[model samples]
Target: MPADTPTPDEVWALLTHLVIDTRDQWKRAVTERTGLPFSRIRVLRRLRPGPKTVKELAHAAAMDAPAATVTVNHLEELGLVAREIDPANRRQKQVSITAAGRTVLNTALATPDPAPASITALSNEELRALHEILGKLQH
Candidate 1:
């Protein structure tokens, strides 16, 4: 690396591409293992933390509210997710993952590592450095 090279912003763009590419690959692997589309898997994964309104899920998943609702409807049909009336807002509903959904997520997690040993070989320091660098890029 040359000190007189491109500015930090240029390096940040490259770093963003690298991170996105890696995430896309991981999403693809999860989709293949679960037989669920990447979008659906992402929605379910977001709900793992807790139930969320359709609007909240949409924002978290970086999708429009209408699209998120449609996806939630499909998952509902599969018996993987359900909607509950929001206690705070009687007119609103919150989506939550069912036991079946948890089962599917657990199975996906249990799937043997399809990634190469090189990924597993990274030391804690290297992993922390990558995380910190990505965090900076995100901000």
Candidate 2:
């Protein structure tokens, strides 16, 4: 311990706080701009690549099966998603985003977040170093 360095606990606290703050910021902006709730946006994002059963969507969206069904139902009514019976399992409902959903997803994601002063103040070297550290933690 160098006096100038933050202890691990202090670093974790700061990192989690910043992550939550940043997530909340864009979550709100995207929801407002796309006129879709965050849950719907998440469900749409998960379906962008391909269709998934409602159970899969529930796992990806961090919700229970019932909630996922409700969300998918709303998206379907809005023409944002299409639901079909999974061929492999006739009883399971598979959901996929519609063409209009792609448009909304793009529009929602394209909404930019202005860099906060703290980030803007960092030098390229600092940014790279921070990126490297975060990448390590992810692994």
Candidate 3:
């Protein structure tokens, strides 16, 4: 380690800052490109694997039930998602991304999230080291 190695608290702050900053930039880009809120895009991505009940979606998306319902309602209006009565539990509704929703997500995927200036300024060796270190982090 370098003599100037960051303290644990400093490392924590930097990690959290990087996460918030990077996520904000990516979310902004995706929302601007797709004309959809980041939350909706997240829901659509979560549904790509398979259909899920609104409760399950809320849980997976870390949203409350009412928020999920409002989001699902908007997407349903746009025909981006389809909600149907759950055969397993008729009281619950299952939501799935429509073909149009997949197209929107694909469009969102094309949004460019350019590297931050600090990252772009790193030397090739430093970038390689960062890549390796990040890979070693838990998924």
Candidate 4:
């Protein structure tokens, strides 16, 4: 198994597993710390940039519009998010993370984790290589 001749299937499988496991673990940790469902946290993170309509958020989050609406409703109940009338489209509503949501996001990010230190041990060059390789797969 030479470095240049690594098996593509093996690489893809490893990457896939890493992604799923990382997401599940991170979601569990965030939910434990914030007492908010992982789905709600995801919705809040997506809204951090700016307000987005339910349809937009659903598409971005890979969820259906109806599901997004339900999640948004729950988040709204928790005071973590808000819905505003879309000025451009009177019938449409846009969602945004409230100040409370921002605080939750910050707390989630600040929560201690022992895994990151091990991950950070990789040299800058190795990280750059990994990033470059991963970036090529997005297409």
- Which candidate achieves the best TM-score against the true structure? 3
Order by lDDT, highest first: 3, 2, 4, 1
lDDT score of residue 24 within candidate 2: 77
In model 1, which runs have C-alpha deviations exceeding 4 angstroms? 1-8, 110-139
Q: Give the per-residue lDDT of model 4 (tens digit) for 8-122.
A: 8988898777666666677788889999888877888899999999999999888999999999999899898899999999998999999999999888877765544445888
- Higher-ranked by TM-score: 2 or 4: 2
Per-residue lDDT value at 7 in model 1: 87
Q: What is the TM-score ranking, best to worst?
A: 3, 2, 4, 1
Model 2: lDDT to the true structure: 0.90
Show pairs that collide, candidate 4.
none
Q: Candidate 4 — what's its lDDT?
A: 0.86
Q: Residue-wise lDDT of candidate 1 within 78-118, one digit each (tens)?
A: 98899999999989999999999988787666656453445
Clashing pairs in 2: none
What range of 10 consecutive residues in model 4 has the weakest lDDT sum? 110-119
Off by over 4 Å in 2: 1-14, 134-139
Give per-residue lDDT, candidate 1, residue 92.
96
- What is the clash count for each candidate, in the order shown? 0, 0, 0, 0
**TM-scores of the models, in the given order?**
0.72, 0.81, 0.83, 0.75
**Clashing residue pairs in candidate 3 (N, C-alpha, C atoms within 3 angstroms):** none
- Residue pairs of candidate 1 with colliding backbone atoms: none
- Please state every model's RMSD to the true fold in angstroms: 4.3, 2.8, 2.7, 4.0
lDDT leader: 3
